[model samples]
Target: MDRPTNPTLIILAFFAIYVIWGSTYLLNKIAVTELPAFMLAGLRFVVAGILILIIAKIMRLHILINWRQFFNTIIAGFLFLSFGNGVVVWALKFVDSGFAALEISAQPLLILLLMRVLQGKKIQLMSVVGVVLGFIGIYLLVSQKEIIRQEGSVLGMFLIFLAMLSWGYGSLFVSKADLPKNYLVNTGYQMLTGGGLMLLFSPIIGEKWTSPVSWSTEVQLSMLLLILFGSIVAFTAFNYLLQVVSPEKVATSTYVNPIIALILGWYFLDEQITLQSIIAAIVLLTGVYFINTRKKLVLFSRFSGKLSENK
Candidate 1:
């Protein structure tokens, strides 16, 4: 029999990824109220990266890697952070945090597609169903007259879609790429690389901090939270979970994240949650569940059949 999971560890990890990551959307939205998108993201990662590296060193853990591994980490960082996170941060200027979370919840569907297209992974029957349901959910979310009527909303949603795609690709790429054996070390390098790139482009893009020193307490707190909880704690928990649990299970956190994000967004940001969005959240999460759970479901069906035959 498989070893039972430590309930405490599971709870803590789940709390980290589900609640911490979910809150990031709203916190990011708040942070951008005064900070430029690239600058906010760049500083968040750089600080988080340095902090993590320092922690690893203090713990006497290995943090060294060769040049090739460093390069790979940098590429993965740019894909995952610069484009994935950076664009999403920029898009938040137009999209509501709740809506953005709902859209980003589509990451699993995109990841599966990228795997099939790039790595030639076989597409299962339930996978097809999941993809179709995901598309239907997207249509439901975006097809509303209000969203369609507003050009900025449409553009924001499109940008979010691109961000999701970039994130998915980066995730799959990192899974296959060579990096430091320690997940924390690899992640630290990635953050440093991606953050450096963001800082580099910030000036080129004319992203200015209009009132960096005068940022409100809320924005300042939001940025600090993103750096500490979102980047450091949640990400470390996620990476550690990948080593302990099946990635399918890890990915399931995406389903819970949107619900938390919606609640937070509504409560704190006073963001509206429409009926269509509610339906979309259900449909999309259902599709994601189908995609992530299909393997276990197949095994359960086979076990049930054997039990029936024995009876």
Candidate 2:
């Protein structure tokens, strides 16, 4: 039999993903203001990756892996970080941090559809409802003329959507991919490979590199927080949660992250939160709830049926 999980660890992990991951949007927004997007992300993850490896070494953890695992880590790094997150950071230039978070909140819907397309999994009834609500919420959120009319806003939204697709597919891939048994090692490798790729591509696109010493205090602080909390702590928590919990449960972070991002963005960055955006967030998050709850509802109904039969 499997040993029971430590409830405290579970709670702490969830808190990290919920709160820390949420704050990354604001952090990235702050950093990307003064830093080149790919370069900023590349540096953050590379540093975080190196730190994690050093920590693993200090702990005497096995850090070696087979070629297959190495290749898989590279793929995960590309899908989840290099293209998925790096592109999103690039998009943040034209979009509000909160707006980008809200848009990315529809990730579960994309995942569900990808499941159907890739795995031949059938979408349950509740999930179907969720998919519809998710689309409606997205339409409402993106259809606002003022928001999209901003220069580069439309392109940003489109790039964010593409990033979401990469992330959605990455989510499915990682669940089954043969990765390092040590979550820390896995995370470290992914970060290293992903960040390395970003660094490679940063200059190919004509992005001018600047020294970190020239960065403003706020941007410097933001980058530090992102590397420490967002990349190291929160992502480690994320990798741990994936092994312990259902993907749907892991996805519940979606519900809380956008709320935290919205609040932080409004408070710190003076980003506008319109009434329509509020409504869309409600609808969109509700859809995410439905998608996540489907499995639980089924399990509950089956248990109730068993009890009735026993009675």
- After superposition on all C-alphas, the RMSD of every candidate to the true structure, in Å, is 3.6, 3.7
Enumerate residue pairs that collide in model 2.
none
Question: Model 1 scores what on Cα lDDT?
Answer: 0.88
Q: lDDT tens digits, residues 1-311, model 1?
A: 76567778977998999999999999999987678999989888988999999999998998988999999999999999988999999898887898899989888899999999999999777778789999999889988886667658888999999988889989888888888988788889989999989989998999875555688899988988999999998988887788778888788787989999999999999988889989998998888877777464677579889999999
Quick one: best TM-score, which candidate?
A: 1
Task: Give lDDT tens digits, candidate 2, residues 145-205.
Answer: 8798889999999999999999999999999999999988998999999999999999999
**Given candidate 2, what's the lDDT at residue 226?**
96
Task: List the candidate 1 regions with Cα displacement exceeding 4 Å.
Answer: 1-6, 210-212, 243-249, 296-311
lDDT of 2: 0.93
Sequence-dependent TM-score of model 1? 0.90
Per-candidate TM vs. native? 0.90, 0.90
